[model samples]
Target: MTSIDPQAKFRTGAVDMTHGGGGRAMAVLIEDLFHRHLKNTILDQGHDAAVLEMPPGRLVMSTDAHVISPLFFPGGDIGSLSVHGTLNDLAMAGARPVSLTASFILEEGFPLADLERIVISMARAAREAGVPVVSGDTKVVEKGKGDGVFITTTGVGVLPEGVSISPAAAKPGQAVLLSGTIGDHGVAILSKRENLTFETEIQSDSAALHGLVGSMVDAVPGISVLRDPTRGGLATALNEIAHASKVGVMLDEGEIPVRPDVEGVCELLGLDPLYVANEGKLICICEASDADRLLEIMKAHPLGQNAAKIGEIVEDTDCMVVMKTGFGGSRVVDWLSGEQLPRIC
Candidate 1:
């Protein structure tokens, strides 16, 4: 790779086929934009792959792809969303994330300014999460063949000894907890796509949750299961845990917090808050004895201030998730039948 002029016309230029042809243009893009923002010791090594030193513990890895439409939203863009999404997956497994690798598929004719913005956002998110992007690859597709850009991020983490969390770990007499309010991210994306406005702006809750997870693990290492309800939201997540553990879940609708504005938007759109996506919230299942402590730990964290003990696990061969409606009726919260909001983190 060769250095390019500092004033490389990014402000008004667009990506073209030459940028991915493995030549001068490609080198300039890598050196001037990607490397400039995402530089770190390991990444600056300029190797084909990252040489990583693993911590003395179980290895955990997770990968996520971001193809969110509109690319940017009120609270987050595809860049930070990719980082948070992958790191959150590792956190769910009780792992401390070490590093991340990001790959971008850029559409021909995409604006360089926007691409630069995305890279900068990704770098900031990774730095704030105490993780570095150590390796990456980029390619350009034909203009008519792709969206503006798609980001795929993979994260690696280490799980400490005596910590084991899995979907199948939930058992009877366990408590189910939520990290915070739901439907924020999904509604934010929908509002942006549809050009809808509300009295108060709704922002996506796109944040990395590993710090919160670390505190929880330090306090309660015996946590049974942890899951981030992303695409299918809380209802689908609970259904998955129920089937995996062969247990039943009973939830209090009032206990699950949803923002008033989000609820109003859902009602107006004829959508269920339970089926909407969330980027920052998580579902925690643990022994009833540890519930209070876990909730305390979660609530103290910045990301989980709205944490709530929503439900409990029960012995049931059928593996169902039932919720006690605030209206004094109970209903089964089944898996989401279809995509509530597509390309939503």
Candidate 2:
């Protein structure tokens, strides 16, 4: 093996076997690429794992693997999605995320330019969320054996005192609140698919929801449940809560927010927006009495400007989720039968 220039532009090169061989090439890649973008004191220590000084409160952790196709999408990419997904998981637990660890699996021959772009995006997202990527690892696989790149992120957070939020906490007489519109993220990814094009461009609502969650928790500490409707969309997310709490969810189709363009795209594709994925949105279940106050608090936040009270919990032996149609009809909103859109975060 030959020595490589540490100052060389990695963005112009392609990831090769040497980059993942745990030698000088790998060190140069880590220092010049990952370190340069995701620089932080903890990460600068250059250890296999970060030793974080625990903050005052209960600690919570969450991990997510992101392999969203079309690495680059309208509002975000795999890198940002990885950060948001993991952080949101912590936020749903009513914890404030503090640090993150991102691991990247790169395919040989993958363009370094794209990898650099993703890293930069991850850096920005983490910075904006006040969460730093304090540690990470990178590996390379044979070209044909891997996607361009797959990123997994782990997040750690501290839960506030007296705050206990859980899916099983949902109960009858609780109002269901959604942070914002649904299906934007799914629609955005679908529009970018190889042969699919839509009349209007839809941007993925991929964003970090910790701030929004913090605001809601601060206002209403007793909020029963907080969950991000990610992979299986709002329908699947609520269904999970219903089964966990042993309650039924009744939603008003008209009250649920869905962007016009997203609804149109769903109609064209023979899909239900309710079953599509969402990156930034969350489902909040709180006492029906707190519904109005919580809705006001959520709407004041930028992320929840379109927040609405979509439904409520009911006592049901079967723990089913039913939605009242706009035409005054009721229907069952069951678990997602099959994969609606695969590889979507």
Candidate 3:
């Protein structure tokens, strides 16, 4: 019979090669740790694959990797982030995420307890999003060959007909809307890093935006483009769309949403809030006529309560994002150079 405490040794020590050597150690760990938190019929099938009953619609897929330093941070961790990040990507395309696949690369000496904690968090996040991790793979590298752990997640979702949105579809006279405040994710990550001078705590707005996207898509099927501002922030995201769609934008900086604390932090750090990353926000470009209806839908949702109409597309030098300053000046919002926040998911 298997011992009651299969991870007894692993609990008190670091991972060893033998634990993944296709032996008793490996069996015990899988059955004891993974099976405990992720008990489901599909996983129990366990024949090198997860059997799935997928729904009908146009299939949409997205993949993302989570490697942010300080895996555990305010509002989220690498585990929850892995789930939300990929889910949001699919949602941006108006897809309903159904299943996910997770792959883990672990350092040889990482703690088994921490690994278990991450897996539990991943399961919880999937449940909250109404998605499931149908399958996964794990590999171990030499202690120094990898970080504590890095996760790559792939998600498959379904998009309803008549709901097509793309960056190339952005057009002139379209109104631009931002879901909520900006720069929360960037400041949150910076605050947690050492040698950075900051007193107040700032939590990362890392969340899955699928629910909000669904509401918007249902309310307005004619939306032009939907992009989640992630590593490069909102400025770069809009620029990409401008070049792809051959459109120009005139943005009002005062209309863009930014928390007072976030604004203060950016000023203190000499960082432009427009260049800051946001994981929980999105940029939606739609026709001028549809803006009012869409704004109503957005304001009703919790995630988009602070939503605002920030700009409008126009015919000008294509591929240019022009921002009208609050002080009556015009400036171009360009892509960020080099890495402002490295390892930011």
Residue 83 in model 1: lDDT: 95
Q: Model 1, 222-284: lDDT tens per residue? A: 999999999989999999999999999999999999999999999989999999999999999
Count clashes in each candidate, considering only residues at least 3 apart in sequence or on different chains: 0, 0, 0
Could you report the Cα RMSD, in angstroms, for every candidate shown? 1.3, 1.4, 1.8
Which candidate comes out best when scored by TM-score? 1
lDDT of 3: 0.86
Reference-based TM-score, model 3: 0.95
lDDT of each: 0.94, 0.93, 0.86
Whichever of 2 and 3 has more TM-score, that candidate is 2
Q: Number of clashes in model 3?
A: 0
What is the lDDT ranking, best to worst?
1, 2, 3
Top lDDT: which candidate number? 1
Against the hidden reference, what TM-scores do the models get?
0.98, 0.97, 0.95
lDDT for 263 (candidate 3): 90
Which portions of model 2 miss their true places by more than 4 Å? 1-8
